[model samples]
Target: MTFKIALIGCGGMGRRHAHGYIELRKYFDTVEMAAVCDVHHDVAGTVAAEIGEATGSTPDIYTDFDEMLGDADLDGIAIVTSTPMHHRFAIKAMEAGLHVITEKPMGLTLKACRQMREVAKKTGMVLAVAENYRRDPMNRLTRALIEAGAIGTPYFALDIGVGSSDGAVMHSTVWRAKKEQAGGAPLDAGVHNADMLIYLLGGVDSVFAEIAINESQRTLRPMNEVAPVLAEMYNHRREDGYDTGDIVEQTAVDTAFAVIRFKSGAIGQLIMTDTSHGQSLGVSTVSGSSGTMYRPRSRSGESPRIVRGDGTEIMGDALLDLVPGFELDDTLSTLWNGARHISSYDMDFRDIDSKILAYEYLDMVQAAESGRQPEVGPQEGMDALALAYALMESGVSKTPVTVEDVAEGRVSEFQDEVDAEMGI
Candidate 1:
């Protein structure tokens, strides 16, 4: 009973998803890679070959999405396309009688998000978003601790991220730097930050943000002098440390700071930047009435810890000891050093971004088979996007924008541009 699935987009993220599918197919016994499609035939063929090598199934490759959809006997389509094409692909695939799971930020606009959600409802198909960050073990642990009152009556937290993308190959692209395509770094990274807020805290009521293009088209002296420093900051190392091109101009708001007012009366201060040097983007701290919980900057390396207001440490050993004989493959497992670790602390968690995608893929496929919705549905993705757009609107208007405004279509210019561009 292997569920046949096709993957769309053959970029960096696409490859990661393919790799996950190959790995999960061995474990799940419920899904199979059927086809790989990209705008470029060679890229699709290349990914198809990789899938073949891993899954022993060489998927058919296609450059045109419609031709692939029409030809393949796929039960679902996993879309990892760029931001602009997400809505287009998801709508068409759902309309064509296929379940859809798309990469995050759901769609560029609230209108587009609603459209996709409506189509899924009408078609009675599974519509899910591959927001791996929400499935990250540390995040789940943090949420569990908060709910357990380790962080009693959560009030405030910091969502801070600072790192230079200058030498990162993914950030050097045009889609990441342009507003029309991806909404730049704000939407690209901010959506994950926003989702964490909602997942742990609650829905955002409003957001007041200040977005800046600080490092716009700046020239560096030379790579030879700063290669070592650049390598440390970006986490990507090479002999020369200069593969992302000499001259880089970022058109998006690379630096953004926002104040999110949660519907539950909690507050979150979000700080994200691609211009900062020698820092990690994943560091987050949540504070409440009684104690605080902190998630480390690196997911694969560190586990989250909680500290009481009186300075009592909730040790990892004690937490792990609380949940004995817990199955690592159970829903209550968290990623610890690339392995599943069970603890009362995490409750149950997941990891490895692609593995998260595989989990979501399996969920969508199972849901399509059983007539249930995925655990992480498109509405959650839309809510996250609402906060993202509110940040942008607040930044542009120099004031706070209510999530309701963005959710109800009061916020329209940027989304309008996206819809017009995509003919949505």
Candidate 2:
């Protein structure tokens, strides 16, 4: 009925969760954010203030999570900190008898993710990873068409990321630049697409990747500071407030190509290039026996128009069409936030509640308690990682890779490289 929440990382995402709660509070008669925790007291205090502003207010800000947990009557926690700390905090929150919804990719490794999942089960709490792309409006429509038998049993699929991996994607990010904080593109950027791939195409059975770092992707500063001129436009931002971000080095990649085989008799291929740019649909191409979907562009207007396949040619808001509760918004609920508010949403199908994402993750903790499907399982995270780890390995070898290969072997070489740099 009522949920008391705690925020573990008071970064942008932590604040975003607060914003979501604020929006939900205006309409739902259920939840409230109770407290927030961050390493930086200033950031934590500021976000806590923002949450109160949204929902009347009940949040207490704390610099340390343990202190916040100790002091508050918390019911659930949102772990939105850096990737490295996800496993630890998830465990802490579970042990404290609170539900948790975590940011995705689970943790730094499959082992850690598994451990966190186990604890939630033992503690009778919820553990759901925040893989939000699966819920994207565009992506939601795409999934609906596939499920509606629009795409009959997907056989072949392609994930393409063009122009998207540009500098814009890397803004306000340092962890991704350093392999220590980020697992490079395959893990950092591809994870979203990869997880979505799994969501649409079933499970991945194999992988092959060609990974390369771009030496040219480096940022440059004048060797001479006094009377020195800014060589690149990025210099002004760095000099003013950027984190010494002279792409001083291209630690990760300029481009990457990948192929994935899904266990559901489906094949998936992915292409990603930092230097390359363009636009495509659905992040890639999804081809099935029934039809094919061109993810980005809807469909050409014709008798048998080609949006993706040759059979259906229609352009409309598939997003508004497939959702269940979407149509009930204006009739059943109160619409206050904006046009998209549940009350005013004129969707046709049952709207997928993002609230489910939070609840399901908490369900992981609850399943840990009651034993059932918490939104999804811990294995889903592992499978996603295993597929990515395999792709990274294939990229290095310039050979076709299998997800089973990763399941069978250790990626110590790549991991060691990242770990050594991390001083782990």
Candidate 3:
């Protein structure tokens, strides 16, 4: 039985998800895109046309989500809307007896995440977070190696990246610059880093952080200079009046430095900034008693390297030897064309990205069908969000904050405004 799913929020990411459904069909014929919905009819119509052209199946388009939910005849829905709407739509869909997979950060705030989780529990609907980073093959291999003791007795990790956005808005979306809409990179892209760290290492205990907005103003990159995809998205936002001008007064924090303590007794330092002036820096390495493992940025398809205390290095196909039984699971193997041991993939950004999202879709569908949890279910999603929020929450009070406290809504100074604004 093919699982019928509909796409909500037909924006840039929504279009990518539509393409993901197209890609999923190449491997598994167990799902179909039944409908598309957006606040803007033209946007939904355009995406519907694209899906039809690519998959030979046109989806019905709707401007109202309730109308689509009532009339689409879908078994599930993919919530690709903005961050604030994630929990709102997921709860409504799940309460309406449909499974939901929403884009991260799972909810507007911890309170919102809890509300969504409660609805899922009461409705028994499968709710998954569309986190694509940990789904990368390289990340899978890194997790396997860590579990196999290749980097024995892990103790600490450093994940740092500093760069200058030069006043350009991220993704050309104005909402991302608004604190009430997004908590900047620390809550936007940082969630991916948080989830990957948790997947590779373990649960985080507490975080002490300093967060700041180094730049309060941003401008749009020239259309010709930006990628075609982003340029098109910017045009759509402008047409829809979501972003009116090239300049945006950013209200979100753009820089963060945090020290994390893991429940496994491992420590981590996370530093992220998009307001640096001159030189840029990046580092991602996990140190253990025996060796240091170098990790590439997630979804980059780059190979991870390990350097032993004796100065010996292992990488590429040789790294697979560290774990004799290392292999992708049956589903991932099928999605990756039966590759068992792969250090890296030879696909472009869009191709690999869509493939990863397709795997996510398949995971959600199978979990809903089998009455199990998706790989990144509500719990995992909430954990990652809590980790990300720990940074902001700690920064707010100028003190270390426990992840548990953040997740349980015991410490929420940073998120209070957003939660209040969202009325959650």
Candidate 4:
């Protein structure tokens, strides 16, 4: 039952995925890292050595994906590439007779996500999206509490993700800020926010979003000491083949604010920005008819507060103590165990998140063994992307767009541009 997996892309996220594979072997059953692939041979070699040292197994390294697929005997491929290439990589892996797991926003476009889903259906391969945030403990706990009536009859919610990535120091400045590859922070991180909303609340009925580019490459850091040559060399290209500079002409929206109506008749608001002068973390709240749940900070271990309409307030460890009798569903149980692992790992959120990623691999293995779909299956990934695309459409049309509209191809604002750029 050992699943031999090969990893594609050896960047920052790929390193974490490699670590996840190592830990999956330690914590779960047999899950072996067979090979690592990246266009940058040095990066791939470095990651392979690191995994070898960590797991005592030297995984084969390759610079090309096709070489890895053609030679390595892999049961699945973990795609850590950028958003636009998700479908291409996934379809290739599935078509090669291997299961696939991909990082989010599923794919850059809804069309791409559907293509992946259709390919999986035709090939009978299991495809899962690595939505680690949905696997976060607090997210699952919140969902459980709402379902258990701890938050009473849920009616409305607010989720906010405000951060400054336009600054040169931010990791996302390279690609996530671009329109063609990532569709800005709204499509990049916004999909996660929207997915969290859908996971906790329910399917979204409609979305009204306003997207804007408040900061057109406002430099937060002066690369004075560093040579411009080094900076320019590392600056990377945008979707339009232009250099991102101190005064870079950024086309993607640095800010997005959206109002969402769930199919269950609940309403919610989502705000995301990667270009705020003084950026804030993910501060979210979900309000019900009788009480409200609030997460003041975005980090994994931060506890949420619950306040009742009658002024009863519960927070922190006390909240857990009060919910001693809460029932545990399968998903909630897995999240609880995952949360416990986070606490046990000395508050390393990166390690904790990586552990969840490991669990995602385990989900894929389970799907393969049982002939069932993965927990975060293609449809769920598609639904999340559909909401994200709908939000973008709403932003462009200055009106509300239904989830079905986007799911059914009634509205598309950015997909064609992405498709053409990707030559799909």
What lDDT tens digits, residue by residue, belong to model 1 across residues 290-336? 87888654234346677887788775645444334323444323222
Clashes of each: 3, 32, 0, 0
Each prediction's TM-score against the native?
0.86, 0.76, 0.96, 0.88
TM-score, cand. 2 vs. native: 0.76
> Which of candidates 1 and 4 reaches a greater lDDT?
4
**Sort order, lDDT high to low:** 3, 4, 1, 2
TM-score (C-alpha) between model 3 and the true structure:
0.96
Q: What lDDT score goes with residue 419 in model 1?
A: 67
Candidate 3 vs candidate 4, TM-score winner: 3
Steric clash count of candidate 3: 0
Candidate 2 or 4, higher lDDT? 4
Tell me the deviation in Å of residue 268 in model 1: 0.7
Candidate 4 clashing pairs, residues 3+ apart or interchain: none
lDDT of 2 at 386: 62
What 10-residue stretch in candidate 3 is worst by lDDT? 233-242
In candidate 1, the residue pairs with backbone N, CA or C atoms under 3 Å apart (3 or more residues apart, or in different chains) clash, namely: 332-348, 333-348, 333-349
Off by over 4 Å in 3: 222-239, 242-245
